[model samples]
Target: MILTAFLTAAVLVASGGTATAAAPGTVAASDREVQFVSDGVPAYGTLHVPAHRAGARVPAALLIPGSGPTNRDGDEPPTVTPGTLKLLANALDQDGVATLRFDKYGTGRTGLGGLDPAALDLPTFTRQAVAAEQTLAKQPEVDRDEVSIVGHSEGGLQAMLVARRVRVKSLVLLAPQDLRLLDLLKIQLDAQVTAADQTALSKVITDFRAGRELDYTGMSTQLATFLQQAIFSPVNTRFVRSDDAVYPPSVARPGPRVLLTCGTQDTQVPCWTTSPLAAALRTLPRPLPVDHFQHAPGTRVNDQVLDPSVVTALRTFLEHR
Candidate 1:
């Protein structure tokens, strides 16, 4: 189900701590618990301000997590513990940049928030991120005009959506899916099947995307099951249609400074696949230079410890602006 969910639609979607400390190096940062109501759901998150810069306004970012049920920390838990977003927040905090990361409708303390999980869709998630962005900008310690959005994997797509409706100084996409959801899935499924099977899978995807009734004949058991659970299920129908309607390249506008990164070892969104995105960004309104980092080695589907070089690149990119 996890793999099917990722292949079908992709999942997209900080606080402060500390008052006064005796020693300067004793504290990292404070996790200021924050909240915002989105679509009538009270979302929860943390605001992280560096220990040294707790009282001063600082350039900040709203961190959006990837995939399903991921929390503010960027961990899906028990089964996945990359801690990607939390590590990012820590790095940004240490660099004196405040961050806000939250749990979406289905995850963490914000679970469902009394809404039916089946009714969740991308627009609501975008609303949540937008609200978080506004909340971050309003922070006393955050420089509103200097705010940015950093989204990983599916969250990168969400970042683009949020930026369309809000103001952000920059966008950092980490291992984001570069192709449209179905296109990426076609390539992914093609890799595991024969030519005939690929053709059949393509037909199935085409029919589904066109809103035609699906004929699952000739599909492998795995593909049929995946289609049923990930794409055909009523719980996923609305979300898949909404997400598929978006093509990231078309949404890549010329406003904000953009930085895109893809990991060499990341099977989901490989470096080569992001060339289209990189190209789109290069042709932006003013055609400014886009900082593309696609050579981080040893980065996996999830990194328990984020690559130091990647972390450095992110800091340099955000700080450069």
Candidate 2:
């Protein structure tokens, strides 16, 4: 479920300090360290703002990370090599857009984010996102009403959740998933199981639904461990029950602007599964304004976030009228 743009991290300072925001042609640190409390847990974030220009305030976005141990930059390495989000933040700053990217539970300085990993739940992430959004909105450099939520992978799904609950300016979903939590898991796991082990895996899913013990008698130790920790873990059941989280129709209405990006080669949350997020926006009850771009030339992604195409496309999308 580590489904973000399979991306990477930030260039935040070790403690609260300021950095020079880069000129478009330059690559500067571009951010300030900020703090927000989620569910009473202290969460730290990197706030990327345009260089203070004549006391101007720019639109802000909350950059949310995907699942597992993804850092503020969208990376959970060994599985990814900093593809999408971190670069996107820098690109946005150059465009005069401010952004806030937070470290999720069990990651970076937030390390546990004041929540025990063993007792974590999906709400923890949602709370963190919302809290971070609220925190960003309070910044004097931000236009509160224009604060948007940009989520990659699972972060995209989380963005949908935030949109429905909060009155935000827009949404940006990067390789956002369309399937229900458990169903997506089933498909992904099925790909790994052999025809010989199909029955056993099927039984495991059945048992999980029925709240029975998982019997991994003949399964490889690695696979079994994966199933136990990632799939059947008690910490994630609430999400499994959310029924595909939010779908396209749900996101179609009541938002300022929505940009959905798809990387043609994204295998984890294949951009094709959801019938193009743009379609949902186009067919909305109110026919909302939408912008989307899929790398038609089939860009090869390093994880889900590192593609240069993602940064370029996003900069264009944000700059579009």
Candidate 3:
């Protein structure tokens, strides 16, 4: 049941028209561009260092990109104002913490390896993030033992997997989905299509849950197949079913702290998705501190820029601990 829903969501994203904004080449004086080879391909990133960290090693964060082709600066095709990770990096830098934000496997200035997005799996995603972390840890200005991961959206899942395998000091998850991939996908599709006034979402979800192909009106055939491959693929099923708590609190070496954040107005990854994950973590025998922050949406808002409050919260969390 979960597998079906997961596949459907993957399909929706593949066929969805969420655009990426163009990358802007602006940076503060303390920040510099860096590149490293991941899986033999060069990946681009920006390293933001604090001005006061002239000789002292500073706490560092590896900013993980969310789903899709978002660039190192968090700018996507459709719009450009928010500059997601880029904004976070600047804020952290100002607060005396160093940060590294990079493009995903095939996005921005990074090279694409001829891999189809429909065929990409969680393991592949995890590897990219781990490589990024490894790259950042080797930097002279970054305190290797004090480094942490700040993963947003799908990146949160990847960060968890990496932390379990590597020695890291902490983790920060933003609007992470704790449910099985399939279930999360189903909910997302239902909400998105319903908001769009598309009646086909209901039929598609029903058919998908029954382990059947979804033949809905108004869905293009190309999109239909793409969705099928993305959602129902064996790769995605294995990811959602795997035991992810290998680094349980009872035995987590070099035990890392954790912080989770969600926006009340975020329909994409609502607060409900994070609550269960937080609850489950609390039940662990050697649980680390889990902090939660909720941002209330404003009526008149700035869409093209990062929320100042969110950045401030992140700065405080990453720098203090």
Candidate 4:
């Protein structure tokens, strides 16, 4: 768990007031502040629609952010301000695609809605994604039939789940994780700890699976803190359990066209690791159309700036879809 597309048309929606117009000579997308209620939480986001010939309904995408308290712009501020989603939204706008990017419960203006963050579960976020998709599809300016889900990192996992629940034009997975959640965590943690500490990490996972409280005894402060924040904490327990239960390869089902992208420099979700997902998709009962886009050298998943190759590849994928 780490955390983060386009078209043109009449850009109005019932969830918000009129869409804002782009200034003269600027290739800015028409932006509108939009809202949707998910599980009684009023989620806030921005709808970006590219300027196109009047009366033309363009293809659209629902931008789902990655893990953690990432905002609608795919940033965890004060330190992490990648703005990955925002830049992708702008890129999609240039490609004549509309997008809806929203702040999840714990981030930005959403602010957890008086709910306890410790009690948050994966279903809460899944419901939000589904609701956002519904909202985007219902927009008068979006071609619902041509709508897609462009998910990055953990969002790619969420996108797979969303695709099973709702029909979409395609699935765009950016540096998505292909391994089971806990397994991936083990790999990440192993890289940081000594062989002895790795044993402790394994025990921690075992204790978690056994429904016992994680024992951080004898662990390094750094590893313990990371476990507390990202894994063993009550705040993420429910979500972690739910996420771990999901095997990514199992969800690569037939239905939507799939575009899986990976950056060679992404140490988190390596390009080679995506093979399981691709192989699963290939083995589906029905043949599924899938495209793989490998980024140029030096493109890492955590790039503060969007990689141009990714933008171009994504635009081409959506354009052909």
lDDT by residue for model 2 over 9-88, one digit each (tens)?
12223356577655665434456787665334566778887765555677888888777778787666666645356766
- TM-score for candidate 3, residues paired by index: 0.70
User: lDDT (0-100) at residue 159 of candidate 3?
Assistant: 71
Where model 4 places Cα greater than 4 Å from the true spot, the runs are: 1-28, 283-304
Where's the lowest-lDDT run of ten residues in candidate 1?
A: 1-10
Ranking by lDDT: 4, 1, 2, 3
Compared with the true structure, the alpha-carbon lDDT of candidate 4 equals 0.74
TM values, all candidates: 0.85, 0.78, 0.70, 0.85
Each model's lDDT: 0.72, 0.63, 0.58, 0.74
Could you give the candidate ranking by TM-score, starting with the highest?
4, 1, 2, 3
Q: What is the alpha-carbon RMSD of candidate 2 to the true structure?
A: 6.2
Of candidate 3, the 10-residue stretch with the lowest lDDT total is 4-13
lDDT of 3 by residue, 1-321 (tens): 111001111100011212223234422235566666643456666777665423567788888766556678765655532466776676676666788887665667664645454455566666667777887788777788888898776666667777977788888777665655555665666664443323555566566556576575776555456555665456443433342322222222334777766666666666666655665445221111222212234422224345555766676666568
Deviation in Å, model 3, residue 232 alpha carbon: 7.2
Candidate 2 Cα errors over 4 Å, as ranges:
1-15, 21-30, 77-83, 217-222, 234-254, 276-305
- lDDT measured at residue 136 in model 2 versus the true structure, 0 to 100: 80
